[model samples]
Target: MASAESASLGRKVRTAARWSLVNTVVLRLGNFATGIVLARFALGPAEWGVYGVAQTVLMVLLSANELGVGLAVVRWEGDLRRFAPTVQTLSTLSSGLLYLVLFAAAPALADALGSPSASWVLRVMCVSVVLDGLAQVPNGVITREFAQIRRLVLDSVNFGISTGVTLGLAFAGWGAMSFAVGALAGNAASLLGAVIAAPGAFRFGWNRAEAGALLRFGLPLAGASLLALGVVNVDTLIVGATLGKVALGYYVLAFNMSGWPVRVVSEAARRVSFAGFSRLAESAGPALADGFSRALRVLVTGTVPMCVLLAGLAAPVVGLVYGHEWLPAARALPWLMALGLTRIGCELAYDCLVAIGARHALLAVQGLWLAALIPTLFGGARLDGIAGVSAGHALVAAGLVVPAFLLALRRGGIGVRVVARACAWPFLAGAAMAAVLVGLPRALGHSLLALAAASAGALAVYALGVLPTRHALLGVEPRHGRHARPRALLPGPSRPPVPPPRHSSESDPEPLLDGTGADGVRP
Candidate 1:
């Protein structure tokens, strides 16, 4: 019976992973294509730089928007729905507070980030954070069920709406504001979809016991997640402050391009990995270690070739897709590609470490990354402009953060050997692909058609190189035990088990706000 249940869980995980990959691939491709249009048609580096600033602020806010409690729906067992009202109350209140903070401080924040012009855009784009918070309950419910198809539909709705709105506005000369508005529209659509998916999820209620348990569980993870985001977004802050907006725009473009390859595989894997790893962690030791190894191996194998191609062909890619006017971005693309590749592995390690309830380890690793990043980024900007910044970012990730995360994984019984063995093949294949790409420019010439053919050929090489791991890619996780503990909603190492939400909760139909309805709507 246990064997049958394990097999069933494994099958579900595999299915969810497949759907998530498809969803990510489609959305990223759409986003990529849309960016090319915007970059080439209605916007310039300066506009993108400003948009980058606002986008950065919005992301940081979103990181901690729910204060981490909505995850309770997935983190605990025993009628998870009982925790919904408290999670909803906390999520809504926290997001509202964050939005107010953003609104009141938008000007100062913009100036601090060195893009005073981004103040209005920052205010507009950040509306999504509030919506994201409101949607957290339904979102968590969906996540707990492995409902990736519904998620795909929700995100597709967001993408389509954002695309339509952004394009229309950009063509109408809205510039950076177009992204702000489009993103806001997309989030609104997504929140509606979430409500439809999980009816009655949005309500005002608070269980004192559940609230305390959630705060204990969520705060550290939120802090760590925020730091993780800082590790990524602070680069924009540094570039804008040092090189000014246009240069920041170029850097943002290059960095986004680098993320293309990384996002293709990493985002999909992450959607299910944390939950899946949490389940495996309950089984402990070997099962957890082995599952992570396979997950890392698959992600690294898939990511390597794309990273190599993008980094290798950065010049033509920028010139052909976004036009030569944006060619300056290519200088930073290679180093950023390197950064993106390293980040994928670290991200998988992040999920594994989090699953094993190593919050302090996650915190320390992220803090170290952020600390190392600020100094290096400033120094890099002082020396060689955006490329130097990219190089600095990549250097810190590979040298400092990656090793730190590896050490953290030791807590999960995954030693250096496990990580090295997982990564060795992908690194070798990537090096070969990189070697080939390095010499391709002279032979292929710098034309759109030539670059296309070369990219196709390079991908074919990667396909052959990684063919040996094809079997492992589909069946990445084995039939592991599925025992889960309530406290592992990602606990800090120093924390103890939550004492049963004080033996449970009571549902409340309090209004969402001063004059709002039970569904959080003001009518």
Candidate 2:
């Protein structure tokens, strides 16, 4: 029985990872393509700068709206339906209030950001806060249920509509307003889609005890998120204020392009892992540690090569995709891309901490990261400008955040050695790929065809280098061997079987929140 359950959970994790990967790739590719069009044809440095500053402000303020409540819903072990209304109500009230505050303070924020046009843009974009807040309840429902297909469908629809509208407006010469409008439209579409797909009673309700429980759980996570937000955006803010909007535009563009692999692959894995780990914790199974190890192995293996390629091809990629005008961004791309490798592991550790209800530990780690990040970013910006900022970011990520994450992992019962072992092959593979990319002839012109061919060759080399470790990468051998029965990463007595719940036609049945549903695994 224990073996069967372990196999079942493993299958579910794999399924979730597969669909999550698909969703992330589709969404990120579409966004990247659309951004290319906007950057190359529709917007210039000044316009993009203004938009970037406003978007950064919006993102910081938007963190308040999130407050980790949605994540709380996913992590909660009891009846999620019972907590839905309270979460929805609180989110709505908080978002509405925050938007109002932002509306009034928009002018000051714009002045501080050194972009007067950003004031109105910020106000216009505030509508998305409320829209996103309302959507979180349904979004949480889908995520908690591991309904990846529904999430993919909803996000695809949202992206299609939003990108179409943004491109149309940009072509019409709306400038930064296009971004605000597109964002608002996307949020609206996502909310509608989420509500329709994940049907639930999401209404205003006040449950004092439930709300307290949620706040207690979510507040520390929120602090951690805020600290993270500050770390991410502070450099952009500094660049904008000190170096001017055009320079800031270049920096933002570089940062985005460099961080693409992390956003696409690492984030996908984190989302799925969080859901899977939450379920595993509820089951009190040793798979929590095993899942963490395997997920880290796969995430590192998958992301390292992509990051290496991005760093190696930074020049041609920027020239070809975003045009030569944006080539200055390439200078910062390599360092930022290197920084992304560290981020993959840190993200996994943070998710593991959250899954196990170690919010305070997560908070402490984020605080330490912020302590190292701010001074480094400021000094870097002052010393070498944007490149310095990127270098500083890379240094801090490797020196501080990575170590902090390993400590958090240890606190969560995962050993640093486990992660190190998982990382060894990927690092070697990535190093080989980087060497090939750097050593190869620079005779190729900066064209899409040239870049494509080079990327293919680099990927081939990486594949060959890592080929012998295929079983580990694919999770085929588990901790033993191919034919051995799967065992948990940590030794423990098997959990007693949980009795099946009784159901009646008269009483509406609640679906099991065991990361599965009647159809199969929910993912």
Candidate 3:
């Protein structure tokens, strides 16, 4: 019975992962294209710098905006209808309070981040927090049920509306405020879609006991998530404060450019990772460790070439995509690329930890990261400007934080040996790919065709190098001299059919909350 249940949920997880990957890839590509247009004509570095500050603030706020109760919709057994009203109430109230605080303190906060001019932008853009709060219940329903197809349609609407509005306003000379307004419109679309996906999901009901249980369960998770987000966003603050807005702008561009693989692969995986891992934890089987190793291997293998090539081809990519004026961003891109690769592994580990109720451990690792980051980041900016900061950020993530996380995972039975094994092949392939890209002659012109050809060549080498990951990607455990098909993707002839998932008398518990369903499109 237990094996059957795992198999059923495994099917759902794989199917959800497929759709989620599609959703993230499509939206990221759309956002990337829109960003190119904006960078080329609509906005310059200073404007982008201010927008980046506002964006950083929004991401940080959104991480804790709901106080983390929304995930309860995914993890708890029994009828969601019993406690969903309270979840909505708690989410809405918390977000409303947070927005109010930000509204009153925007100027001071913007100034602290070295962007006083962005005070208004921060105020306007953070309105989505309240909208996110109101919609968390419905969105949680969507995630719990692995409803990525619905999410895709909804997020597409958000992308179209946001992109159209931002472009129109930028052309009309609204500056950074254009991004804020456009984001507001986009979040509204997200809310509407969430409601449509799960009707009557946003109701206000307060059960003191239920609310207490939720807070008990959620606060630690929220704190951990906030710290995790801080580990990523605090650099923007440090950059803006230690350097100037223009330097901050360069760093932001470089960092975002480096995030291509992390966003596309990690975002999609995380949308379902917590819920899936939570289910796996309940089974208390070796499946969690096995699944973790496989997922980590796949992510590292797929992400390696992208990160390596982006780092190697940073100069051409920034030059061709954002124009010659933005070439300075290239210097910081390689270091940020390393950071992006580290984040993919760490984030997957984070979801696994969160699912197994390892919130304290998460808080410790993330807090240590943020605590270490402030000094390193500031010192780096004082040394080599944005590039130094990027190098410093990557250093902390790989050197300090990655080891810390591995220890925590080791405590959870996912040994360092497992991680090392998973990472060994991908890391070797990435290094080889990097060598090829870095060794390439500078004779290649800065044209699109030239960049594409170089990237294709580097990636082809990477593909061949990581050919052993093929079985893993297909969801089969790889063992030497034991080649077998992945039953997850294509079950064998004699394998029993996975049993259908049984619904509770009250509701199906299938989805979880992602911190950014506060809607994570950067400005």
Candidate 4:
């Protein structure tokens, strides 16, 4: 019975991972393509710089307002319906207050970033904060339920609307305001979709007990989030302050381009793995350990090669897609790509800790990472400008963040030796691919088509090189006890059915947040 349940959970994880991957590819690709159009044809570096500064400030505020409540919602094992009202009330009130604070502080932040126009942009974008807060309940509900397809549809709708509006306004010469306005529109649309998809009463109610429980679970995660905000945006802030807006613009562009692999692949895996790991942690022991190991293997295998490819092909890619005017971005890409590679491991480790409710440990790791990152980032910006910032960021990630992540994983029973073995083959494969890319003939490397072909060839070589480790790569072997083995990467028909919840009652609604219903939606 235990083996059957493990197999069932594994199937669900695989399915969720697949759908999340689809969503990430579609949403990120759209955003990436639209950004190219905005950077190359519609907006200049100075404009992107202004927008980037405003966006960074807004993100910091948003992270604070969120306070990691969505994670609390997922991690909670109690009755979610009983808990919903308190979550909603706290979220709405906090966001409203945060918005007021951001609005008041906009001018000062704008002065700090050296963009007078960013003051108004920051004020305008603060409206989405409240809307995002209101939507968190439903968003959390959807994710908790593993309703990936519905989530995907909503994300697609939001991305399409936001991109269209932003691009249209950019072409109309609205500049940075285009991003602010488009974000507001997108948030509104997404909120509406969430309400429709996960309909439930959201009224003013407060339960002190529930709120306390949530705070205990969420505060440490929120601290980690705050530190993360620093690690991600402090460099942008430093570059804008020291190097001027145009340089910051080039740096932001390179940062975005280099983050494609992490954002699309690692993040996708994280979305699924967090929930799966949370569920498995209830069972604990070898099941959770094995799940973590498999997830780590999958994340490294997929992301390392992509990061290598991006770093190796940075110059041609930037020149062809975004034009030569943005060539400065190319120079920063390799360092940023290296940073992304290390980040994949760090982020996965963070998620694993969160799933197991290891908040203090998570906080400690993030605090250490932030401590290392701030001085390194500022020092690099002062020394070598944008490229130096990128190099410093990569150095901190590889040196500090990666080691911290490995340590955190050890707390969850994932040994360093296990992680090293999983990562070894992918790194070797990626190194071979990087070598081939570097050795490509100049004639073939000069054109976009040739570059694309070369990249495909390199990927093919990586695939072939990793073929000997296919079973481990695919996680075909069960990591724990000898029992029912999963066919392929998913559960088969022989997998056992899950038992009904013990707490079900006539007055209580079904546990829609548990993803046990047929439609996978809350009524």
By TM-score, how accurate is candidate 1?
A: 0.90
lDDT of 1 by residue, 1-523 (tens): 5455556567767778889889888888888888999899899999999988987777778778877666566656567657788888998899999999999999998998888999999998888778877887887777667788987888788888888998999999998999888888877887899899878776778789879888877777777878987988899999999999999999999988988878778877777777676566556477677788888888898889888988888887889899999999999999999999999988888777766668788889999999999999999999999999999999999988887888888866999999888888778777777766666756988677877777777777777777766556645323344432221111111222232334222110101111000111100
Residue lDDT tens for model 3, 274-300: 667766664443567877887788788
Q: What ranking of all candidate models by TM-score puts the best one first?
A: 3, 1, 4, 2
Task: Using TM-score as the measure, name the better of candidate 1 and candidate 3.
Answer: 3
- Candidate 4 lands at a TM-score of 0.90
Q: After superposition, how far is residue 27 of candidate 4 from its true place, in Å?
A: 1.1
TM-score of each: 0.90, 0.89, 0.92, 0.90
Q: What are the runs in model 3 whose C-alpha is more than 4 Å off?
A: 442-453, 477-483, 489-523
Question: Candidate 2 at residue 226, lDDT?
Answer: 68
Q: State each model's CA lDDT, in order.
A: 0.77, 0.71, 0.79, 0.72
**Alpha-carbon shift of residue 38 in model 2 (angstroms):** 0.8
* Candidate 3 TM-score, C-alpha based: 0.92
Backbone clashes in model 1? 0
Query: What is candidate 3's CA lDDT for residue 450?
Result: 69
Model 4, span 163-223: residue lDDT tens: 7788899999999898888877777787788888887834457888877766655566667
